[model samples]
Every structure is written in C-alpha cells, then in structure tokens.
Target: MKNEIIPYILANYPDLQTTKELLIHCHKLGIKYVELGIPFSDPSADGPVIQNAATKACINFNFDNLLAILLDLKKQNINLEITIMTYANPLYIYGISNFYTNFSSANVKGLLVPDIPFEERKVLTRKNHSIKNVWMISDNLPSASLKKIVSNSNFYLYLVAYLGTTGKNIQQSDSLKSTIAQVKKIKDIPVAIGFGIKDKNDVTNILNIADGAIIGTSLIIELDKSLNSAKEFLNNIIL
Candidate 1:
C-alpha cells in the first residue's frame, strides 16, 4: 500500500553478495517496493531474461540463499516493502502456513503467485491475510472473478501490461487500455502495471492511469550490460 513502484529483481544475481548489494543500491535510488523472484527449476511464465536469471539461480542459489538475501536487507535497515514472486510448488513444499509465517516474519509485504487461482487462494488466505496475498488479473480473467480477486487482495492489484510470458514489447494494446479502464471503474486500490515497460516514457504513459509501474526485464537487461549505467538510468526514472 506504500506507493508500490516495484522494480523486479531476477533474483539470480551472479552471487548472493551482489544480489544484496543491488538491492541496497535500488533502495538508495528511492525504490518504494521491490518484487524479487524466487528462482525455481522451471519458470514457466517467464521470458528469456527471467529464465536465464532462474537458470543461474538454480545453479548457485537456493531458498536459504534467497532467505539470506531478504534477511540481509533487513540487516541493512532497508525500509522498502518486499514481495516474493514465485511459483506455487515451492510454497506447497514449504507448507503454505509456514511459508506465510516465514515471509511475514521476514517483513515481506506480499506475494505474486502467477499459477495460483482465486479458489486456491481461499486455502492460503485464511492463514495468511497477515501478509498481503496479491493476485494477478490478465485480460483473460472474467470480470466477476477479477473483482473478487481485487477485493481479496491486501496489496494493490498487479496488472500485467502485456500477456505472453514477461518479455519486452512495443505498443500497448487496446485490450490493455480497456482493462485498465475497467479496473479503474471497479476500485480505487493502487494498480501497478508491469511486463516489458522499458524506460521513462513507458512510466509516463502508464502513470496517467496506473497508480504505479513495475519494471524488470529492461532494468535487468541494462544491469546485465552495465551496472553503473543501469543505476544511472534507474536514478533518472521518475515516478
């Protein structure tokens, strides 16, 4: 709820130390909220950039490592809100109650589970409303169900800007515009849009309607290319 301008982290940083460092850097850049991926063997909804991040994470990272990264943020006194983007299998393995408990204990504000459905959320919601259980509503989600999901979400709704796995794309669709207009009609909760938002111009276009923007692949690509330059660009990205 605290002005969620999420900049996604691939979570597959070259090393844990570097990941922590990058998080610290982002915090310094005045990022209000961050959604970091929990690397899994198969990141089905991810595109090439996220897939590569997951691959690297699997080879060098684990849940404990990710937990350490979060804990490190706490240690650094970074007050930015945190959300974990991951698949459901890991949560099931961790036990939904225990996973929620752990995340709440770590000061995580929310979660983004692409695979979880509204009916399934009822199961987790009972035990975990303490932490924001965020949900996604694509262009495909029915109007009734989307309203239900948004009403249920404690965190602001996450609206995917472009469909097909998270990747770079040019031009917003008429579908996306209608969806935003529809969501605006339903509720006043913060609505943050993501997937392929590349630069300041993208944010400018989205901010007129959306409460905030979530950017990832572009920043990661930039970071992968040059950290310093990426940081400079990030610093320049106004709300």
Candidate 2:
C-alpha cells in the first residue's frame, strides 16, 4: 500500500457541505484515507480544538445523517477508505448491530473509538461487518498490553505521538521511536501515528517509523479558516 496520509474531519462541523468539499479536496491531493469523526456530547479524549468542533457537529450528526453522508460520498465516487471515529455512547445508542452493518455497506473501511478499551469492545467488533476496529496506543503501553493490542487489532494500529488529547505539539522522543519499533517487531501491519502531528516536520519524522500519520486538530484548525486551508496544509506538510 502507498504511504497513507490520513486527514480526520469532524462531521457536520459548521455544515456538511464544507466537510464534503474538504474530503474531496483531500482525495484530489492523493490522500487515500479519511477518518470521519462523529460528534458526541462528552468528547473527553479530545482537545479544545476537536472538542469545539464536536460541540457544533453533535447538533447535526446522527445515525441517519451519518449514513446519508456516507452514501452521498459513495455516489459521488469519493472512493477512499472511510473510517468512523466516535465515542462508544453514540454507537451503543445507535444500536451497534445497525451501525456496523450500515457502515460496511456504505463502504466504510474502519472504526476508531478512542474511549472504548479493547477488553470491553466486544459488541463493536462482534458483527462481522468487515470494518476494522482501530485501537489507539501510545509510547507508554505496557509490554503485555501493547502486544495484545497489536495482535488483536484488525488493520493498522493507531500509535499516538504522545500521551495527550487530539491537539497539541509534542516533541519527538526516544520512547515514541522505541514504541513504534517494538510494534513493528510484533506485527507486520501498518502502524499509523496521530495526536500532536502538527506539520511537515512532525509527519516527516513519524513516517520514518510509521506507515502513515493521522492528522486531526491541525487540519481542523486550518479548515476553520477555509476549505482550501486543508489542501494547503497537505501540500506544505508533504513538500
């Protein structure tokens, strides 16, 4: 697979039109992965940037709205790996069975629920929906737990750049390098890093040990300016 430059977008932020446009722009820029963040009332794991986006997004994001948006993307041929990132509460209330099956049919490739621990996520992974369950990990994971998480994860493992919320600039550390190196030794699948991935320097350093980088807050902060800001960020970061 190509080096995946995945940009995350909180759905219904401002409005869905701008979200769709931004996603299309990403694809046009040669980005193959898109993580669509679902808004929830309590996004505790997120930083202020993502939290604010979620607050506005929650008003317009729902089961029906999500499905509609995915279907729309499919119809428009925005053919990229679409992953849903939401808290467990939204999935449970929406009915896990329906959510997974629907997202699978809608061509969603993965799921990322930062708040749900791997042990208690049986319901989310039980449905045979083919949507990979992405687990979030950091440099501090215990040896046993990290091994288990890497072994249990379906697709790529989400390696957090630092132990913090969605946004914030975290300096590179030997621990982070050691963590990714260890994960690579245990698993053969792609290892993607997120959280604190702010610019070209961040992405460049991360790609040395990771297959991809998951960018959220920084992109959102740019998109907050205008749709073009996302595209600009991608260009600046990659070049």
Candidate 3:
C-alpha cells in the first residue's frame, strides 16, 4: 500500500489566501490528508516554527473565516481530508457543539487536540459527529495506557517520534520500533510518526515501520519562504 504523507499547515498563517493556495497545492500533489492547525495564543505542543506561525496567524484569525475558506474549496470540488488540530481551550471557546457543527458543514474528516488526554477525549467525541478523533501517543507511554488509547482510536494513532515538541530530528531507535510493534500487537492500526520528519528519506524510512509520516515544521519553513517552494518541498518528499 502507498504510505500516507500528511502535511500540517497553520490556518490563516501569513493570510487566508495563502492557506487556500497551500491546500490547493496539496490536493494537486495527490496528498490525501492535511492537518489544519487552528491558531491559539499558546500552542504548547509545538516548537518555535509553529509557535511563530500561530502568533502571526492569531493577528487576523477568525474561525468562521477559516471554515468559509474550506467551504469554498469544497464548492470548487477540491476535496482533501482536513483534520483540524488545536488546543482544548479554543474548542471550548468556540462552543463544543458549534465547533463540531461548523467543521461538519465544511466536510472535515478528523480532529486532533494534542492537549486533550485520552481520558478527557469524551468531551470532544460524540457519536453524532462524523469527525474522527486522531490520538497522539509517544514511546514513553505505559503499555496499559497505550493499549487503551490505540483500542479506542478511530482514524489512526499519531506516534510522536520524540519526547519533545514538534520540529526536532527523529532518531529512529529500537525503542521506537519496539513501541510500534507493541501497538501492532495490541490491535491492527495505522501508526503515523510525527515530530521531526524533514525530507523524502525521512518519509521513506518511516513507511518501512509505520503507515504514514506527518511533516510539519520543515514544510512550514518552506511555506514561510514561498508557496512554490512549499510545493516543491512536498513534491520531493512524497515522490
């Protein structure tokens, strides 16, 4: 099977028009999944790269406008599986029900709230909502906790490659492989490694053990430079 290459982009970064262009470029590149990050005052889980982006995005960020952009894209028949990533506070501020309703209308495929622990996910998950909750796990999680998270996960498990935040180099070790094996043994799930994948070789190497690679910081850096640079970077990695 072809491995999944999921790009994470900050919503309204630089501006909404650039965000729209990036999504179109992603779809043209045949990328099936794109993580749309909702800008928050404090993105604790991300590194300097994403933090800076979020800071810039929050200057003119409007959740409704973001949804409108997605809706417009859908109207034009440019459909990409969008997973909204944000902290728990933003969702609470938006009103949980309203958040789901808006995203559902925009045809979003999943939600990834890193700050919400597995135990607290019930607040965001509802049977009525079609958006799947994407869980993030790390190598350090206890076996029992890991099992519980994986078993309850809907779309796929996001395996954080390192212990730190995003935008770091991933050193593939036996422990990482062992963690993947443990998850596979518990249940059959597609595991995607995030938190430091930089290039095509990183994606290729990750696919050997996991089902997908989530590229964020490096891609964002290229995107910060220019849209065409971003497109070239994504093309090189996914090819």
Candidate 4:
C-alpha cells in the first residue's frame, strides 16, 4: 500500500468556504486523510502558524457550522477521513456525549485530543463513541508507557517527531526511529509522524520509517498564500 500523506487544515481558518474547498481538493488529489483542526482559545500543542490561524478561525467559528461543512462534504460524496484535532476544554464545554453524537453523525472517522493524557482518555471514551481515538506518542516516552499507549491505540498512532510544538523543523533522529520501531513491536498499528513535517523532503524521510506523514504548519503557510499554492505544495509532497 502507498504511504499516507495527511494534511492538517484549521477549520474555517480563512473561512468555511475555503476549508470546504480545500477538502474537495484533497480528495481529488487522492489524499485519503485530512486533520480538521477545531479552533480553540488555547491551543497548547499548536505552533504559532496554526495558533494564529486558530485565533482567526475562532472569531467566527460555529461548532454546528463546522459539522455542517463535513455533512456537506459527505453529501457531495467526498470521503476524506477527517480527524478532528482539538483540546480537551472544548470537548468538555460542548459536552463529550453531545460532541461524539454530532461528529459521528457527520461521519468523522477519528478524534485527536492532545491535551488529554492517556489516563484521562477514558473521560472521552467512556460513552463508547464510534469515532476512533487517535493517540499521540512522542520520542521521550518510556518503554512501558509507550507499550500501553500503542496497545490502546484505536485508529493509528500519532508520533510526535520532536520534543517541541508543531511548526518547528524535524530532526529525524535515531530516537525517533527507535520509537517507531518500538511501537511496531508493541502493535501493528499505522504510525504517522507529525510536528515539524514541513515539505516533500520531510514527508519522504518520514515515509522511510513510519506509515505516514502529517503536514500542518508548512501546508498552513502555503494556504496563507493561495489555495492553488496549497494544491501545488500538496501535489509535490503527497506522492
């Protein structure tokens, strides 16, 4: 199977229309997965690029509207697997049960709650939600902790490439390679590395070790230029 190239887009960043259009473009490009970031007041895991975009997106973000965008894409037969990435606070305010109901109804495939620790994930999973939980693992995790996280991972494992927030340059160290190897040994789940994955070269390097590469900050930067620019950038990296 071809390695996955998942692009992360902030919901209603520039606007809802553009967000929808970008999803359509991604589908056309043969990209099966897209991370739709829900704007939050405090995005702890996000770097400045995505953080700034989220700040702007929050200005007019409507949770219902975001769901509607997904529903609309479904209506159009766009089958991009959307994983909603957000903090735990927003999920709490929205009510966890209600959040899962709406997202599952809209056909969301996965959920990535970065701020929630492994132990606290039960707070989100207690309801037996249909949407798969995407767990995050980093290079610094202890072997036992990593094993636990990998064993519990539902859809896939999101491996943080570096120790910092998103948008920094990835180092592709031996520790990262060792982490991926360890996860593979623990479980057979697909591991997708993010945080500092910038361009085609970055994606290419990641594909050498992991199952996928998630582009966020760099793609967001291209999107800031134009949708066409974003398309071009993705085209170069996706293969």
- Candidate 1 — which residues are off by over 4 angstroms? 1-4, 126-129
Estimate, for each residue in 109-222, the C-alpha lDDT of model 1 and write its tens digit: 888888887778765664434677777877888999887877666678888886688876736677777877787678767788888788888877777667778888887788
Write model 3 residue lDDT over 71-145, tens digit each, in one string. Answer: 999998998989899899888888888888888878698889999989898788666778888899998999999
What stretches of model 2 exceed 4 Å from their correct place?
none
Candidate 2: the clashing residue pairs are none
**What local lDDT score does residue 173 receive in model 1, on the 0 to 100 scale?**
70
Greater lDDT among 1 and 4 belongs to: 4
Candidate 1: count the clashes. Answer: 0
Answer with 1 or 3, whichever has the higher lDDT. 3
List, residue by residue over 1-239, the lDDT tens digit for candidate 4.
Answer: 13999899888979999998889989999889888898887788989999888888888787888889889889889988889998888778888888888988776988899998787877887556789889898988888989888898868989999888899989979998999889888878899999999888888899998888899999889999998898888888865
Task: Give the lowest summed-lDDT range of ten residues in model 1.
Answer: 122-131
Writing each residue's lDDT as its tens digit, candidate 2 over 1-239 gives 34777888888887888777777777777778888888887898899999988888897577777688778878988788888888988888998878877888777888899888787767675745688888988887789999999888778888888777878886778887788778878987788888888877778787776788888899888888877777788777755
Each prediction's RMSD to truth: 2.2, 1.5, 1.3, 1.3
How much is the lDDT of residue 212 in candidate 3? 84
Q: TM-scores, in order shown?
A: 0.89, 0.94, 0.96, 0.96
In candidate 3, how many Å is residue 91 off? Answer: 1.2
**What lDDT score is found at residue 47 in candidate 3?**
93
Q: Candidate 2, residue 128: CA error in Å? A: 2.8
lDDT of each: 0.75, 0.82, 0.88, 0.87
- Better candidate number, 2 or 4, judged by lDDT: 4
Worst 10 residues of 2 by lDDT: 120-129
C-alpha-based local distance difference test score of model 4:
0.87
Q: How far is candidate 4 from the true structure (C-alpha RMSD, Å)?
A: 1.3
